[model samples]
Structures are given as structure tokens and as C-alpha cells.
Target chain A: MRGRARDGDEQRFLDITGEIGPELLRYFQRRIGSDAPDLVAEVMVTVWRKRALLPLEHEHARMWCFGIARNLLRNYSRGEQRRSELSRALRATVSVTDVELDSEEAVAIRDLIYQLGPDLAEVVTLTHWEGFSLAEIARLQGVPAATVRGRYRRARLALLAALSTDVAPTLL
Target chain B: MTQDKDHPAGTDRELGALLARGARPTTEATTEVRDQLAEMAAAIVSTNQARSRRRAGLISVIVAPILVLGVAGTAYAVTNIDWSQLWHNTPEWAEWAQDPDATVHYALPGGGTCELRLGEVVYSPDPNRPADVAADPRAEQAARDFLRTADLLTVADVDAMITAMRDKDENWAQADDGTAVPFGYGTDNYNADVEYNMAVKQAIQVAVTDHVESMGIPSTGLGFQSQEQCTGADQ
Candidate 1:
């Protein structure tokens, strides 16, 4: 019975890995560009380590994986200087055209999302990009729903201001 | 683009849609990266399984003996067993010998004694004592390097080396300085003897140096001396 349960857990882990593996790869690619492959390996290893504790529901498990990825990114960054260094490094290596942004407007929006700072940027990413609700993000982040809501609100305001300024020059 | 207090929802919905579209995944996972992730997952599962088996075995060993004993005997056994010793009683080689009173005095090559306690060189009667007798800053670092090398050797490799060294037919020669060196054993097959001898010697050197340094002793000129040799020298 114990062996069977363990086998079931392994299967569940593999199932989730297959489902989200490509999404996770792209997630890291968007953030770290060429370093994504290595980061994906790291994130998968962590997911395997926490397999026993992962939620049975697929949706919750996906969020749990993202939570681990977020922690890994924070650890990798270590400081604001390192974070900026990573951004600069990625920018140097990857062209805007290579990023597959649909249009110039899309590139501008993506750039503005990054300007919201790491904390607000993550909140916006989880909400819009990942399609996690504020409550789901709160649970993943171990914070209150209200905190995520406030962060998302602030991030949206920043994005709106940046967008308006970007268009104002053309209008003038 | 116009901001309205009552219709803040419109602005949020528009921005959210834009972000969602922009951040959508545009690339696929390469076959190589996927395969590497699969390999890592398998390795993690294997490791966890081994850990779980070890934990189960340990728990059974502890629990089975208590069950065999009567209730009163079990209680007595639990109370009598020194739980502290389980963690504190590490092998002398592995332990950081920090007890101040448990000092080991070594005879210098020239004359007089070098007193080592914990990691400190408390006293050295030798006139040629280094300026820093308290500790060799490099000793711990050297020991760490040795440990990293030692980690590569498996238990079977270490056991094979020991067995070969102990064999009478194995050419265990004594150098002019009286250090025992093993040779010719397991040499024809695998060069196991040479590898083992080097590894063991390095381990012993690191252990002795690390122990002395723990007591704040200058590990310069200090060599690996067994407790028996030091005791016999004292006599």
C-alpha cells in the first residue's frame, strides 16, 4: 500500500511536469533569456523535492511551482545591483525582435511592466500573465489577498502613466 | 485613455488584456532541456526513496528493542540512554577537538613540547615557535581542500585500500623518517594501492592538522601522530 501510494505520487509529479514544463521554460526565458534552460532544470529539481507536499489539484500545484520559482529568482538576484546586472546581461544578449513581441506597442508594454520594480512586477505577472487571481497569489506568496490587490493596483497605475507618456510624444 | 473614477474597471481591464497578450509564451521547450529535467526528476526520486528506507530502518531498530523490553524496562532504557552522546560522540577524526583540558602535547623534532588544546597551541617550549602560535590560518583551509578530495572516494574504495594495506604480502615499506607507506598491493589490477595510500595519508594529515588548529595551535611542522605514539613518547 505504501509503495502504491509512492508510485501514485511519482506519477502525479510526472503528469504535472509534462503539463507545465514548457510554460515554466518560457517563464524563465522571459526573465533570464539564455539562462532559462539551467533555471528550468533547477526549478524542476525543486518541484521533484517538494513532490510529496505538492497539492493534488493541478491548478494549486502549478501555483506552488511558481512560488518556488519566485524564491529561486530572489535568491539568484541577491540584491538590486545583481538584478539590474541580470537585466543588462539579458538585454545585451537578446534583441527586442528576438523576444517575439507582436508589435512596437507590445514591446513598450513589456518594458513598462519591468519598470514597475520586482515586487510590483511579480504581482502584475502572476495576475495577468499567469492568470492567477489575487487570492491565489496571496496563498502562493503567504500574504493576505488585500496585499496582492494593493500591489496589482499600484502596478496598473504605474503602467498606465508610462503608457500615456509613451504616446504623448507622438501626439505632440 | 480618459480616467474616470466610477469606471476604473475599464482602464484595469484594458491594461490587463495588454499584459496578458504581451507576456504569452512564444517559445517551446527544446528536447535536450526536457530530457535533462526528466533525468533530474528521476535522480531526486531515487534519493528520496533511499532516504525514506534509511529512516524506516533506524526507527525500527530503536522501536523493536523497546517493545521487547517490559514497560518498566523500556522506561528505564529510555531514561538511561544518553541521547546527548548520539550527537556529541562523533569519531575523533571527524570531531572538532575543542576541549581545553584535554590537551595533547607533541614532542618537536628539535626538543621540548608543543601543547595543543582544542584548536589552540597553548604553550610551546621550543624556541623556534612561529610568531603566530595561536593558530595556522591556512590549516583549516587546507583541511577543507583535503575533505573535498576525500568526498570523491566511496566506502568500498576506502575498505579495499585498508585491506590491501593490512595484507602481509603487500609491500608496506617504512621511509627513512619512519612513516609507513603502502605499495605493490592492488597495483597490478587497478592501482588501488597507490590511490588508497595517498587518499588515507591526506585524510590523516587533514584530520590531525584540523584538530590541532581547532585548539588555536600553529600547525607548522606538525605531522600525523597516533594517540598511542604520543602517549608512548610521553612515557
Candidate 2:
């Protein structure tokens, strides 16, 4: 009987792995680049260890994984170089499209987004890049949805203002 | 575009498109890595399960005897058992027991000491030994029996068993003087406990011996060697 329960837990954990494993990998990749795979494995092991605490709702479960990934990322960020160096490192390994990395417009826009400060930049990246809604980002960030929305507004206006002066002709 | 709660309007569709380009499309592990991850998960689950089983077994072994004794109106002794002496090596026992890990030792009903690490034997006195090999296989088996029937047995469990034995002993002494009529127990109850006490002690002796000597094949049933018998030697 205990064996059956354990088998069930193992299967459920694997199912969770299949569902969010990819997104978790990308979440790490976006932040830490090559270390993402190792971190993903670590997160899966941790999820299994703390499987009892996993939320039952599907969205919450997914967010639960992202939450773990986010915390791990924070720990990883400590004692590391700046995010730009990580971006450059990730960029080297990945093949990019003409607009993604090759184009001058893309580079200028990326730079402007980086200059938006970590809080604003994160809200924009989470919204645009990861495709999370403001509410979901709010949950992941453990802040109010309105706070995320405000940050998003601030980030967009800053990027728009910067684009208008320097890169507007090329980008617009 | 219509403004909605989820997506704010006029957030520059062009800018959104540009930012979206940087998003890495769904990272996937190779077939090899996925297989490895599954294997890792299995190992972790199996390891945890084994630990759980060992702990559960330990608890049952320790609790069952106490529960049985609780029924015999001998429950008062439950709180009196020195549980630490059963599970942990005391400084006094550490000097002669040889292994600091050994929490307690029992003298096999016949001969030899059964050194135990919490109801499990770590060392056993060997009757078959050439005086060179310190551990006796039968002694270990005796310990196993002692553990099994004795109920990972708390001192209370031993006390109950001893009480039964001593009650009979007192009756026998009185019977010798032709005075006392073994009160509260008929001949059967005393006989059962006496036989049980020996069977448990012998079984533990056999199990510990078989276990330590053979290292394979476990003996069935629980047995306990006489604690009083060994306590005398240790003190």
C-alpha cells in the first residue's frame, strides 16, 4: 500500500516536470543562461522534496514552480556579475533572428530596456518576453497587481521616450 | 486594440513585437537529459521510501510490546523503562560493551552477551568461537529474538517480563517452603510466561546468531534474552 502511494507521488512529480519543466528551463535561461539546465534539475528535486506543499490548483502549481525558480535565481544572482554579462553570455550560445539580436534597432531597444532599472525592466520583460499577465506577474513577484501595472506603465513610457529621441526612426 | 484589464492599450504593438523577439522559444532538454532526470527522480523517491520503512519498522518493534503489556495491568511500568539505555549507549555500558554505538547488551539464556544497537544486535557472544573472534553468531540471533518479542522493548517491557518471571520464582520459593499458594495466577499463566520467556530469549539468540554469522536469512518471531541476567554482569 505504501509502495503504491510512493509510486503515485513519483508519477505526479514527473507529470509536473513534463508540464512546467520547459518553462522553468526558459525562466532560468533568461536569467542565468547556461546554468539553467542544472538549476532546472535542482528545482525538480526540490519540488519532489517539498511535493507535499505543492498547491492543488493548476495555475497556482505552475506559479509554485516559477516561485521556486525565482527564488533560486535570486540566490544565483548573488556573488555574480551584472545581468548584461549574463545576457551577453546567453546571447553567444543562442542563435538569434535578425530582429532579435542582429539588427541595430534590436540592440538599441534592448539597451534602452536595460536602462529602465531592474524593477521596471523586470515587469516589461515578464510581460512581453515571458508572456505573463500583470496579475500573474504580481503573484510571482508577491506584490499587488496594481503595483505591477504601475511598473509596466513606467517602463513602457521610459522606453518610448528613449526610442523617440535616438532609435525612433529605425524602430518606429 | 481594445483596452482590457489583462493588457493595457497603446503599449506600442511595435515595441511589444520587438521585445517578444528576445524571448527564447520553449527550452527543451534533449532526450538523454530527460531520461537522466527521470532516473534521478526515481533514485530520490526510492531512497526516501527505504528510510521511511526502516523508521516505521523501528517504531512498531518498540511500541507493540508496550501495547501488549499495557493490557496485562502491567502498564504502570511503561513510564519506568529507561528508553535512553535501549537506544543510546550510556557512559557506564560504554566501557565494557566495547562498541560505543551499542546501547545495551543481554546475556543469552545459556551464555554469551548480545550487544545491541537499539533492538538490533551489533555484537554477539559466540559459543562456537575459537576465543579469537569476538562476536558470536547465536548471541546476535538471541539479541534479535530479544528485540522482536521484547518489543524494541522499553525497560518497562523488560520489567513486565521480569515481573512475570519473578512472580513465578517467588511462588516456587514459597512452594518449596510449602507456604505460599501462587496468588492471582493459576499454574497455566506462570507456565505460559516462563515458557514464553525462554522461547523469546532462545529465538533472539538464534536470530542474532544466524544474522551475524550467516549475514543472510532472518529468523522469524521476536525473542528477548534475560535483561536481569545481563545487567548483573554489566554492573
Candidate 3:
């Protein structure tokens, strides 16, 4: 009986990891860049440990994993900034640019998105980049679907306004 | 470099396309990374299962003697033995023996084991007097000492202890809704885990309220409490 149970868990785990593992890598990469793989590995182990809590529906499961990835990214960002500051003081000047992880185009657009503030940028990123609908983003972000919709609308208008200015030529 | 398929027409389409191109992952998780992730997860799950089994075995080793001693103590209780002489000869302070309620035995995070018996009035041993002569009432001090050593305990440690306890229960499958139980079982285990977690947490709260209130030391109320008299080579 235990043998069959173990087999079932192994299969469930495989199904979950196969579905979300790559997407989580992409999710973290968009936010954290070079540290993404290690964080993806951390998220995988967390997903495995918390497999029972995973939503049965595929889309909802993706949202659940995204929620975990977002939380981890927040913690990493907070701690990483402090650590990097301390390290910078002690170490010699080094570039530390991760060419493989951060593309020039992505970084440029990311800077532009950040101009919209965190809530707006989050709605835009989740909607456009991660391919979550407003309703799904609401569930992940713990807000109403209408709220997410409003943020996305505001973001679009803001980005368009920016684009119509001096930056329009470069973006186009 | 990215396909523009998601957004509707006009400026929305252009903005969405740009965002998609910009925020897209620079590197996808390759086949090798995925395989390595699976292997790492498998190893973690397997190690936890093995540890659970070891803990289950350890519980039996701990519980079997307690069960035998319970029976022996019951017989001794009824026999009307010499109270003073027996108390003197016992050599060790066994509060759980005297007052059995609210005792929890758990492993320390670093190493060794602790048995905590709460709300029991402890008496300083007197060879000339009867066992029930007087209650020294040092349970607060014992609880305080317990808190000192248990500073390292965390919620994860508590959950791990609960998992260990659950693993030892042969009737756990039948105890919950009858389904083929996995190592990490579904909703039933989750509910049980939450309930057990709450009970242990409440036990700590009760211990704090009972003992720490008088010390006037505001209880930060972290981790489990233990009896210093209960631990060590004397046990």
C-alpha cells in the first residue's frame, strides 16, 4: 500500500515540476536575472515540499507557484541589496554584469516599466510577460480582478504617454 | 525577437508586444537544469521519508519503556509503599510520574531529547518527610530554565516533530479519511497537521500564562518549554 502511495506522489511531483519548473525559471529571470537558476532550484524544492497545497487546476497551480516565486524574489532582493553593499566596500571594482541572464533590450524596457511604480509595473508584467489574465493576477496578488484591470489600464495609458514623447522614436 | 500574439489592437498591442519582448526570460531552463531540479527534489523527499521512519522507530523506543513504567507505577501507587523512603530512594525527580497531564517529549534541534511536564507543583526532595509533605512550587523556575534552552526551536522544528509523531501511528491511514496515504498525505493530513500544530502552540501559550506571569518577565513566548530537573544524566 505504501509502495503504491509513493509511486503516486512521485508521478504527481513529476507532473507539477514538469509544468511549472521552466515557467518559474522564466518568472525569476525576469525579476532577478543571474541568480534566477539558483532561485528556480529553491522554488522547485519548495514546490516539492508543498506539493499537497498545490491547486488541482493547471492555471491555478501556475498562479500558486508564481506566488511562491514572487515571495522568494522579494526576500532575495531585500537581502541581496544589503549583502552586495557590504561586499562592494571590501572588494576591488568588478563589472559583475551577467550577459547571459540580462539582455540589453529587457533591461531598457524594465527601466521604463519601473517608472510606472511597483503596483502598475507588476500588473503589466504579470499580464503581458507571464501571460496571466487579470482575474488570475488578482488571485495571485490578493486583490480584486477589477483592481488589476484598472492598474493594467493605467499602466498602458502611462506607457503610451511616455512613448509619444522624446522616447517614442527610440522605442519605435 | 518575441512573437506578438497576446494583446488586442491599437497601442495596447504595441505596448504588450514591447513588454513581452523586454520581460521575456533571457535564458530558458534547459533540459539539464530541469533534470537536475527533479533529482534534487527527489533526493530531498527521499531523505525526509527516511528521517520520518527513523523518528517513528525512535518514538517506539521512547514510548515502550514509558508504557511499561506506567503499569509498574500504577501497581506501586496502589500498594501503599513507604512514602518517605520511596521518595528518598527514587533519586531522580520524575514530575510526570506524579502528575501525568500535559507532558510532551520532543527532540532538541541541535541534539538530545527533552521531556516537558507543565503545571505540576514540584517539591524539593526531603528524605525525612513524606512525598506529599509540601509543594516547593518551582515549576515556574523549571519552565523559565526550559525556555532558556529551547530558544533555538522554530515552527519548522515543531512541524518536523509532528511529522515524526504522525509517522509512528500505524492507524494514521484509518485515523484520517480512508485513502491510500502518501508520505505527505492530502487534505486530511493537512487538517491534522494544522490541528496538531495549534495544540502544541497552545500548550506553549498555556505554559507561558501559568508560569511566566509571576516572574514579571514579559514572555516573548517562543519555542517549547522544558523542566531542567527532568533532563540530564539523572534521567
How many backbone clashes does every candidate have? 11, 20, 0
Classify candidate 2 by CAPRI docking class.
incorrect
Interface DockQ per candidate:
0.13, 0.09, 0.19
Interface RMSD of 3: 11.7
Docking class of 3: incorrect
Give the least accurate 10-residue stretch of model 1 chain B, judged by summed lDDT.
B65-74
Model 3 spans > 4 angstroms off: A1-7, A78-98, A101-105, A165-169, B1-11, B57-235
Tell me the lDDT of model 2 at A34. 56
lDDT winner, 1 or 3: 3
Q: What is every candidate's alpha-carbon RMSD to the true fold?
A: 19.8, 18.8, 16.4
- The all-Cα superposition gives candidate 1 an RMSD in Å to the true structure of 19.8
Ranking by lDDT: 3, 2, 1
Local error of candidate 1 at residue A172 (angstroms) = 15
TM-score winner? 3
Write down the worst ten-residue block by lDDT for model 2 chain B.
B63-72
TM-score of each: 0.44, 0.45, 0.51
